[model samples]
Target: MNEIDILKKIASNLTERKSTAALSNYEVLCNNIAFSHDLFEKGIVYLEFIIDHLKSIFNDRLSLKGDFRENECLHPFISVIPSLLLNDLEVIKKLSAYTPPDNRHGITIDNVSLLHRGFMNYNNLATATRQLIDSLVTDSYQLQLLDPKEFNYHVLLSLNSFEKYATKSIRQGLFNQEIEDALLEFRKLNFKDWKNSSITKCQHITFSNKVDHLFTNLNLVASEDIKFKNEINNLFKFSSEFTHIGYISTFFTSQAGSQVVFGSEKSPYLPSTENFSELKYQILETCINFIHKVYLPSLSSCVSKIFSSSQELVIEKHISNLVSLLKEGIKTRNNSYYFFVCSSLIGSQRIIDLPCLCGHLNKWRPPHSNSDLFCTGCGSSYNILAIEGDPGYIITGNGPVKVIGSEAPDFQDLPKEKQQEMLIKVAEFNANGSGN
Candidate 1:
């Protein structure tokens, strides 16, 4: 049977089971399907069931008003809506278009206000979904799936649907032209270039810049509370760094081979496939958590702060929420020892030059180098040894030197005099005839 049919059967069977094991399996199956394809309505049904099943897990009775109020509910609900089938799209589109003021059919203003707050909660889901889609499509280094052509086709199809819904809901289009242009450009993108490109760079910069503008606008509206302005600015700066530069730098370092900056006066090395994959997963999780737990909450609270009266309780609540989110984010960062472990694993790939280090030029060298010369390719010095009665010199090294990879120091950027001076230093060092 197709995935949908199977999910339907599982959902049907779930209603018949009273056992916790069966319910847990149903939840896992639902989550897995939700993770893969958001279009699955059956997955949604299953999730609703899971929520009801787990209702007792919550404490405060007021907090148990609905499945949506729980923070944990946000991730799963957001996950399932995007890949949902076209027929099911209307339900999600309706959810997105929900506005509180209209909900009471022109009744009391208090009811309208309550509905508006309800809409905000739903809007958070939409924003979360958009963020998740962006994350999945633009992984670290901005690489799409191994097959860009296939991924772009899917993205284009989704963009068309997105535009239609956006136009209908917003009463005006925002991303229609931008989405079309991006799709067109995507078609022409070279896979290699896309792989190397920093997908987060432009988006991160835009978001960071937007935060600055947001603060500026807020400062104009906010009362002349210097302390409040300062706090908001600090929060903006922290969010900008967390989203843009800090996370990107961590991801780039994890992916772009090792560095010589830490521990044991040794050079950095390329990471193993497993090590790189693990780090990549950790970085991805960190980014996802930051967006969900930190960025979204901060933006939502800031919006409320900007619009609502400056009641001390409301202000304190928002500020406390921001602080709590940041603390959680900080705690998630891996310890220094983890970084050292990753670096040590990376260092094992260092290159060791042989013959050139021993003052012998007659020995055969690797194809990238000639004779017993120092190999610029791998950043290692070799030596050539003329063993008694040997037909030719043997090439060897005192120890393995770390490979510098493609981003080694650029000699071409240096002035000619400086370049010559560096070469002279290298020559003198080699003439001294010591591996040390």
Candidate 2:
């Protein structure tokens, strides 16, 4: 059956017998799906923001006066976001297909298999979310701090560090002799003295290193809070279980009352189903906070650092939306959710039907100061550019949606520099023919 039909079939049966846990799998799945569903929307905006800002930076710097390393540094980030997003959507889909063990069958072998798959998917989701955290916070730190050559080299070393694992893997005949010979040849060809090169011995700057350097690079108030590091470390520790174990999260589309089957380890006391929902929510909340409290500030600083030589605001125009969103988030986070309606008290509202990309009319009144304009229809809010006589325009991140798969091939699959070459080719082709 098709995925939607399968999901419908699965979700159409959440009703339960008396033997299940305190919360029925139906209710537990509902809460988790609802949480992840909301997160999916937030995650999209967050990823889009990153890609959009990256687009601004890439397009602006792609034509720089000198050095190919600038583009090289950017290449890793291009594929990573799209890949994570694909995983995110998939996790939610799998979760939607979730159902608890049918106690009516007394936890049969089939039910055990079902539960095992559910938890496994949950772990995968956790790991993917953790990876997303790095893409947003840790990766942004590198972009804003390191020079292009240094950053690109770090990524290269990380990607090409198969030598160490292979050479000393301790797994008997992990690689065939032919592959072994190829690896040796590859290292010899690339690194003249693979055995003695100091650069080869050096470790890439890790997420913790990036976090450590975040404050040193920029003097933000949260720099001294110490909680960002603690939270991120804790998040990694939690996801490490799932990342290695390969278990995990789910899709949001489900009907109430579906009988679900899940596997669990035998224990003195079974853990409550509520725990996963809370944990997933907490991780996502932490991700959002890191983006706002850490990445955005670091990114703004990076933009200035990067364009320090230029006089005009080449990339800031595109990035200002992110800063604006951060500002709005900080402004309203502590206050009431309905404070925006109260905002109309202080500033006059403009009734314009400037169409939003969400297919909703943007007739809502914006703040008099032209800060961030939030579309009520799609809830996609960003900084509204207030130009004279131009009723302001929406700069939807407008980053390439299919950069990895359909447009230029997956960046991860490409060899060093080939992704960049293919990307430019795709850009050129799309530019000439209007991306038909």
Top-TM-score structure, candidate number:
2
For each of the candidates, the C-alpha root-mean-square deviation to the true structure, in angstroms, is: 29.7, 16.1
In each prediction, how many residue pairs overlap at the backbone (N, C-alpha, C within less than 3 A)? 17, 33
lDDT per residue (tens digit) for residues 1-436 in model 2: 8999987855554332223343433333333344334333433444354444444544455433343225554444444434433444444344323322212234454443332223554665676765666556545665565454454444445445754665455434555675455455445644644423533322235667666677556554364457667778678767766666632222211212333344433211122333344455465556656655666566566555444345226445434443444333333332221111222233455454444433345554545444435666546664432223321111112111221112334333545344333333333333243331
Find the 10 residues in a row with the least total lDDT in model 1.
Answer: 334-343
lDDT of 1 by residue, 198-274 (tens): 22113222333334433443343355434433433343344344334444234223322222211111111111311
Model 1 CA deviation exceeding 4 Å by range: 1-273, 276-278, 285-319, 325-436
- Model 2's number of clashes is 33
Candidate 1's error at 91, in angstroms? 18
lDDT of 2 at 99: 23
